[model samples]
Target: MRDKIESSLESAIFNSRWLLAPFYLLLILGILALFVKMLKEVAGLFHILMTGEGNLIIAILGMVDVTLVANLLLIVVFSGYENFISKLDVAHNSVDKPSWMGKVSYADLKLKLIGSIVAISAIDLLKAFVNIQSTDQTQLAWQIGIHLTFVVSGVLFAVMDRIAFGGKH
Candidate 1:
């Protein structure tokens, strides 16, 4: 009975593989959505700058936000699919998985993800800075606070990664 149940469970998991098909489809949709969002941001910036109503610094900072997010999304989607869900047969045949992918092991992925979030937060702080009408000391203080959070979080992740990997605590 035990053997039979284990075999049945294996079969069920195999059959459930089809459930991931929709997830893959959604991943494609996400890629398209990112593209559309980036284009919209660009167009909005262009219109604002052309009319001289936009701060060029803020507009450029917004572009950086979009670019970083797009890169983060690509890394998560592709590496996640390759590592957890399915092996990339093509990657195996090619020169080792791309450099970024190689570095993003299951252990390393967590640290990298935390670091990326910190980067995103820093970018947001930068955007806020660009919105200054006059040099507001309070705003600058808040920016420093946010940046410190980013720094602490990054250091924590690094320390945790090293500890978990038995390199350094």
Candidate 2:
């Protein structure tokens, strides 16, 4: 019957969301790689400090940049999984769980993503400014332009989300 065939097709389409689970798992691997890179950077920072060859501020900025990226990845992993896959059944009293884990809607995820991008861009811009003497004028201009673009885009996203959600979120 047409109704039976339609029901089967609907079920198949609904179950297709599971296909996204593997992609999220791959993101976990990417996070592991980022952790390794952060460890290397930390070791390099210590070496520079001991040898007295590198600028301390620049080294610290590098660490901050990595930390921001890790935080962004965490947000994406937790919120993306919850929003797309299924709810995480963590203990209500568990201290290890993030309070915002179950609450970020897709629109909220977009806002968080743009905010992280802006923060990362700002950090890079600050790094460039700190080493301004060594950076070419064109390169500096481009960095500034790119950073401004990110800021503007973030603002626009926030505005649109507010309008779409009636500022309820």
Candidate 3:
């Protein structure tokens, strides 16, 4: 009876992974909201071009920032679900499946996340640089400092991963 009770408890614990399924669905909703924001950015871009008032580079960079964030969320959802919850068997048979799908291990996902963050930070810094005329020197300094921190952290993550995984990736 003790053995049966222990087996039942283990099964229940394993099946609790399904509780995370709803969180992934919420992330999908967040992605849809980002899509709407991107549409608004594109519309404003057209108006800016016609009026020739707003800085086009800044507008374009804003869109790129949104795109990068949306992509990061997607990777998290995919890798998080697959790694934590279950396999995405539907994607496995789909022709349009991303090449990276199913291949990103937990370690790889961490690297990809850091790399995306670094890219996003770089874009923000570039935007600040482009608008240096109005940017506060102190704020700019902070941005640079923060971005460098991310860069250093990313490098450290890569180095640690290499040591931990023996450079297998």
lDDT of 3 by residue, 137-158 (tens): 9999999999999999999999
Alpha-carbon local distance difference test for all models: 0.74, 0.87, 0.95
Better of 1 and 3 by TM-score: 3
Question: What is the Cα-based TM-score of model 1?
Answer: 0.76
lDDT of 2: 0.87
For residues 15-62, could you state the per-residue lDDT of candidate 1 as single tens digits?
676577577667767778878987888898898878988677777777
lDDT tens digits by residue: candidate 2, 42-92: 888898989998777878888888888888888988888888888778745
Superposed by TM-score, candidate 2 places the C-alpha of residue 155 at a distance from the truth, in angstroms, of: 0.5
Residue 116 lDDT in model 2? Answer: 95
What TM-score does structure 3 among the candidates reach? 0.96
The alpha-carbon deviation from the true structure for residue 123 of candidate 2, after best TM-score superposition, in angstroms, is 0.9
lDDT of 3 at 97: 100
Off by over 4 Å in 3: none
CA displacement after TM-score superposition, residue 81 of candidate 3 (Å): 0.7
- 42 Cα displacement, candidate 1 (Å): 1.6
| Runs in model 2 lying further than 4 Å from the true structure | none
